[model samples]
Target chain A: MSMFWIHFKKEMLEAARSYKWIWVPAVFLLLGVMQPVMMYYLPDILMMSGDIPPEAAALITVPPPEEILASTLSQFSTIGLLVLVLSAMNTVAGERSNGTAELVLPRISSVLPMMIAKWAAMMSLLILSFVLGYAGSAYYTSQLIGTLEWGPMLGAGAFYIAWLAWIVTLVLPLGAVLRGPAAAFIALGSAAALTMLASLLPSHLQWSPGRLSAIATECLTGGDPSAWAPAVSAVCFMALSTIAATLLLKRRPLLPQA
Target chain B: MMEPVLRIHNLTKHMGSLTPVKGISFNLERGSCTALLGPNGAGKTTTLRMLAGLLSPSQGEIRYGNSGETGADNQRWQKRIGYLPQYPKFYGWMSGLEYLIFSAKLSGLPGKQAKLRSLEVLEMVGLQEAANRRISGYSGGMKQRLGIAQALVHEPEMILLDEPVSALDPIGRREVMDLLDRLRGEVTILFSTHVLHDAEEVCDRMVLMVDGRIAEQGELSELRAKYRQPLLLLEVEPGEREADWLRSLPERHFIEEAEIRNRAARLVVQDMDEARAALVREMADAGIRFQRIEAGASSLEDMFMKVVGA
Candidate 1:
């Protein structure tokens, strides 16, 4: 729809002007590149620290490129997810609080297109940062450690992105009802709880989207873990959250609280 | 009556326990500029928000044009109306030109037409020179002008502005008021303001609201004549004797209401000529050193004060 594009273009322009495009990907890249380089230089870094003797330092062995990339995915799950959620937390909440929505909402009959455009814009940023960071980590892993298989590496990246996608999408619905930082905090907390639940009873919660992280790591290590259940659920979760955000926004378009 | 451009029947909004807009209704003519005049917390903003479709009414209906159907869920009416809040805020990072284009596009204007209209409205609001400048750097007046421009960019059938000039400096107020004056008859406008002088200056009609209800609404001329009353203003030299004479004048048979402050006394009287003659003769007999005496009709301000105070 043309309306979606118009709003999407505006969102992207806002992202650019706010320097989100620069710092977000840059943070991801730093997080990604740190994983493989740190693993490769563990012995030397330990030696320079003067905390370990030479014989103990010699015992440190470099990890395989697949394992190193999997470690990079873990890093993405922590600091990288936090950065992405922070970037997206203000998408709707900021507009509502700053009084911009009062000017913008009356022009359209429904809030669906605006919600979709915002979600798409956030997704675009998420994919861009994730691709750049994952690629940076892959390139560093192949050079400093061992060559990675293109097939499994791309699959692992896709799975990891899906896992991050659903978590970041939580901010959309949460932001509609709560303030920005509160939304971000709740989204992150939900992700932590879901992942813990999945781990505690892996058989019972096999369909949980939280299992995507582990599935991604398995794919990278040459294990063909089942991805269908979590993938389908992650996509459904995203669609439902977007709809929830649209409905909540439609109910109270002007002020967020009352 | 060419079927009023918009009609509302007992619209109300209940926010939690506070009902800001109690059930009230009014109609707007096709090209008339009507002011929604009220004191603060009189539900002007809540009413405008409901008509603008930002907030759904808890009761009643909004009908647009000749159609009997409610316009609440109609996209056609949504595209035909523009709204500016009491505090109009924009994306500060966006340039004025960009914001206008964005707004016009959202109103369903095509890309080329949106751009052209954006430029036209920018010039109309006297912001063409600042089109490329970011809005955050704009002065308060410039921002208000841009708010008006964005509201006009879509060429909607009507615009609802809440307290449009209430927050401006004197010069800024003058500029916006003049702009509204120029915009009269070109588009229907329903703007809310507590300043009666503003409504009197450019609006042809007024809907004076008090305590979430319309106290009075009619053509400006009709309300002026309806509220018009004989008034006598007498100013005497300051003295205990003159003050006593001024205070005693209020108790006279012809005087209906009186407000005496220091050396001046404003008396509302049944007969202006009789009151003037009696006051002049009394002051002369009492040897009162009166500086000035004037007879006139009361202003709309008195009606406004009376309605709001009640």
Candidate 2:
């Protein structure tokens, strides 16, 4: 148990020394504030671009505050997820590639605590960045567009975090088996495939982890949550990723072959 | 009646099509330092890694205790073992002190005790002054010392170091050797090295590996006595006639096995005095321009070459 905290503290210190805490939240802050501000200034910016006809500028209607927040999530789904994946891609892969695993592996009896520590540390960073971005987006939406129900906004944030959790979880296991960029690409690809499958067959894939994204957006729009399937799947998937990473790390050589 | 610290039997690792560390076996006696001696690609690293629990052997048994009950996947036994790779890498962002503390903590030292142990280990490895420096700024020798520090911080029953001094400069190698010399008997060490002199410097026993097999292994003096042979070394300038004459000298009846190089020959003679006298006479009669001739004995280096020569 103490070993878990020890590893976690070291990981946090690594994150600090690498300046992950600074840049990750900074990117999230930019992505978050850009949404509502851009929607509010869309007409003026479009008019200034001269190529747009007067009719087209008038045709553009600013979305509602709740919908604007949801669109911000879609932005996060793309570039924000990319940022998260790229940063985390090296977590396990670097340890193996750089030969740190050789020094560390023999000291511990089981890899479970180390894997759990890594997952928890990553989750802490993920939640921090997401919360900062969501809050920034919510604050901007309330100021520029309209008032929002704090309860629903927080609810939307939680569901969106759950969705992102499953995606980030992919990094741990993939990083164990593949190099950084390959692992990042595959995690992104898997998330895309699952999300697409969920959208294509919503009823059939109601319990799919990918449904967390839609559930997140629906939370903002006061959509119903009667099914309760996506939530369960998201938690299960997170657990599975943590377990898979530990097992893979155990099965394979700790340090990569020189 | 006491069991060895660790016993390996018929250990083999099949990495894809290539088999490194083929059916090799040796027992590590308690508190004994054994060198996993081998040349490059002779599987020293593979064997050490298996003992370190970093690589599982494809076919073998690693017995840890007197009962020999716990097999290869001895999860609980991992805490008792420490490993430092040939080139031990670190999280470059971490300070030396922080890395040691982390390693100590990972091996189950409590927080306060981990810090205390880390500091003690840093001083032990002569890195206390540079403990706060980030690892990225460390020299090769400092990093190697830190590697040893981390290995010792947890106070494991045994430590495995793979070519600990292989990548260092002369001074760095000497420093590590002296430190290992100081560290021997405190904890059992099984370091790999291709340099016989390095093994002879600190190791009490050695497992000489050749082509993934244990060519020879025992107490340093025992093996030295067992394979030690009175021999002859002859060197001649590389003229065609002199080279031909030196090669012909190995074919004499008294010569046992002859190892001929470009202009040199290392011969194991049945009778050193008779072989030397006859060879000198033959060279003088043939007018061979010999550079140097010495009648001596075999060292570990000679044995190493003979094991790998085939």
Candidate 3:
């Protein structure tokens, strides 16, 4: 426990010192603040260009207040997912490659602590990024659409956090078990592939936490988040993945002086 | 024996289908400085990593001995080991002090204690002045020193340095060697090196590993006494019959073997004093005019060559 905390605190310090938390959030915040503003003026910009054909104009029917909010949330969440996945993939594998991971394993309790500390620190960073991005989107949306009913918006916010948390958790084990940046890319690609497969099913299949970030934007606009029963089914998958990762990583020996 | 701080019995490690580390075993005693000398691809690094607990054996167990019976024993054992890898790459963006402190924490030291120990080890490895500088700015030697500092910050009972001075210049090698030497009698320092001089200067005892096995192991004096041979070189002019005459002197008493090179004969003798006198007598009796005869003590390189050859 002490060793785990020590590793965790050291990671936090490293993150702070490197200002890794700063850049990811700064970029996400910029995107977050711009999403609603862009959504508001895109129609005007299109009208001014006189390129709004009759068929295309049918798709632009002055998006409802709920749809506008959903669009803003999707804008922020999509980028949020990518950045979090990229960051998480490099977590343990990078340290392993750099030869510093072995220096500690021999001195510490077990590989478990190292994996846990890395997971915890990364999750903290992921949560921080999601919250900051969501908050920026919320603030920007209010300025454009004027007023947010704390209830529905908060529910949408909760779903976003849950979906992001689940994705980060799934990526944790892949990042922990594999070596190099390729593992991170593979995890992202797998998540994307899973989402595409899920989309082929009926609305009932679309509630997977992995699929929720994209679908929830529509759900927040009065589409049924409940219609997606796969979210509950995915609970089993995410839990199993987390457990398998822990077990495999616990036994995976640190690469010796090779 | 001081209870063998590290004990590896029949350790075998296989990577995929290739077995790089075979069934090799050795014990490390407390406060004894030993060197693992081997050529490249000889498994020196693999052996050190197994001892440090960084690598698990495919077969066999590494039982770390300490004063305990159960749950707390392994934990206690780990806190006493410091491992410095052959190529330790730090976060180049981090300052030297930041890296040390991070290592201290990872080694299970509390913040305040970690800070104090980091400072102490930085001074020990001569990185105190450069502690605040970015690791990227450090020269190769300085980076190695920082690695050493991080390895020692926890004040482990056993310090395993893998080729600690392999790439350093003469001065940096001396610095690392001096540090390891000073720690002698206080901590068991086992460092692997291909450089024979590093082993000669700092190690009290040594183990020569070849093809993942201990070829020879003991104090220098013991190995010298066992393998030392008095060799004499004779230089003769071109097309001289001196080489044939020297070979005809005999190989029983003083001459162990003889080899001819161009016009010169190289003799392997049993005793230096006896060989010189006998050679002179032989030359006088044979009336052979030789260019020059020179004799000298054998070196570690000679002993290493002989061992490897054997």
Cα-based lDDT for every prediction: 0.91, 0.87, 0.75
Winner on TM-score between 2 and 3 is 2
lDDT of 3 by residue, B34-102 (tens): 999988888888888777766667897676774344347756777888888888778887888888887
Pairs with backbone N, CA or C atoms under 3 Å apart (clashes), candidate 2: none
In order, what DockQ does each candidate have? 0.87, 0.78, 0.62
Residues B153-271 of candidate 2 have per-residue lDDT tens digits of: 88888888989998889988888899888877777889999989999999999998999999889999998898888899888988999877766766688988888988999889987
Candidate 3 per-residue lDDT, tens place, A163-188, comes to: 66666667656755677566767776
For model 1, name the residue pairs that clash: none
Candidate 1 vs. true structure, TM-score: 0.96
Please write out the lDDT profile of model 2 over residues A1-258, one tens digit for every residue: 877887898889899989999999999999999999999999878888899877777898788999999999999999999999888888888787777887888787778888899988889999999999988998999999999998878888888898898899898898888887899999999999999999999889989988788888888888866437888888999899989999898887464454
Candidate 2 residue B307 C-alpha distance from true site, Å: 1.1
Off by over 4 Å in 1: A48-55, A256-258, B71-73
lDDT of 1 by residue, A95-170 (tens): 8878898899998877899999999999999999999999999999989888999999999999999999999999
lDDT of 3 at B170: 89
* DockQ: the better of candidates 2 and 3: 2
Cα RMSD to native, each candidate? Answer: 1.9, 2.8, 3.1
